[model samples]
Target: MVTVDHLVKDYGTLRAVDGVSFTINKGDILGFLGPNGAGKSTTMKMITGFLTPTSGTVTVDGLDVSKNPIEVKRQIGYLPESSAAYPEMTVVEFLTYVAEARGIRDPEELNSRLADVIVNCHLDSVKYRAIENLSKGYRQRVGVAQAIIHDPKVLILDEPTDGLDPNQKHEVRKLIQAMSKDKAIVLSTHILEEVEAICNRVIIIDQGKVLVDETPAEFKARIPGASIDEVFRDLTKGSALA
Candidate 1:
């Protein structure tokens, strides 16, 4: 449901993302892997229509992200690396604002969506609490709740599990996995175990280019017996100096 073609993003002379291309089909959970500054986030921003690429194209559900940004956005839910919230707003109030902003006018549907996301993301305890008063994990859940509030066909998550404890991480992973049953998900994270647990496919990138795009099992098979960490090191070895 997502396709990126020859995508390139240049910052002056630096090519943050160079000719990176990939496609994610329906119900596929793609694990986007790369070291710091490896263009994973750059590619995601382009796909989500958050950042415009210097060249090439990104399409979501056949809609060109550049040409039809609003339509593309309407079909995709995005959770960036860091959660942005109104510190003073309660969880319910924050979500209400998001729903309104997304033009969700059906009061019944909005209420149902709010309840489902709050329960699914385990935000009931803080449902009435101000966002600034909640812990980091709860705040992250709020961010995710807002993203999926519209029930988009695609979900783009950047570092979704960042800063969470093991239990919280597991819960969030389960949520993502469940959501992927009907929606295409592209998630970028440094956590290999998270990928192994939730992602159906893996795409490893280096220096803004795709190095390996394969199923998780096929990715593991490449090293004959090595762990994902080992495979990653082998693929990215000497890349920094190149």
Candidate 2:
């Protein structure tokens, strides 16, 4: 559902993303792992059409992100790193705005979509509360609800569980796993446990390039009997595995 070929993103002289290439198929949950300044977010932004690539191509469902940006965006549901919402708006109101922006016209469908997301994201308790009054976890759920309001074909999440407690994280992960059945979900995060819990495929990137792309088992096998963290360090730091 998503293809990125020879993608490069340069800010004048610095290349934040260099020669990155990958394909995410339908029903796949890809974990994009990278350390700070590893260009993970840069590549995501390019794929989402939020930022143009310096070189190469990205396509969502065969629509070139750069050539058919609007169509590409229409196929994608993006949850950015930060939750950007009108603090004063109630959860329902904010999601209604998102539905309108996504060109959802049917009031019945909109209401149904809103209800589905609110329930899926466990927002029923505060569905009528002001967004600013919700906790950080709830706010993040609100962000995700807005992103998926249109029921896009692909979901791109950047640090989806950044601030949640263990239980909340598990709930969010469950929601993502449920969503992956019919949508291609690509997420960038530093948490290895998150990958282990929800990802079927893992791509480890560093220094603006893809270092390894493999299934969770193969990734762990790189450092036999070692944890995911150990494998991550070995691959990213150019160290010899034990």
> Could you tally the backbone clashes for each prediction?
0, 0
lDDT of 1 by residue, 5-71 (tens): 9999999999999999889998899999987888998899899899999999998888999999999
Candidate 1 clashing pairs, residues 3+ apart or interchain? none
For residues 1-242, write the lDDT of model 2, one tens digit per residue.
99999999999999999999999999999999987888888999999999999999998999999999999999999999997999999999999999999999798998899999999888999999999999999999998898899999999999898878899899989999998999999988868889988999999888899988999999999878999988788676753211
Which residue ranges in model 2 land beyond 4 Å of their true spot? 238-242
As a whole number from 0 to 100, the lDDT of residue 137 in candidate 1 is 81
**Weakest ten-residue segment in model 1 by summed lDDT:** 233-242
lDDT of 1 at 69: 94
Q: What is the lDDT of candidate 1?
A: 0.90
My TM-score estimates for the predictions, one after another, are 0.97, 0.96
* Index of the highest-lDDT prediction: 2
RMSD to the hidden true structure, all candidates? 1.7, 2.5
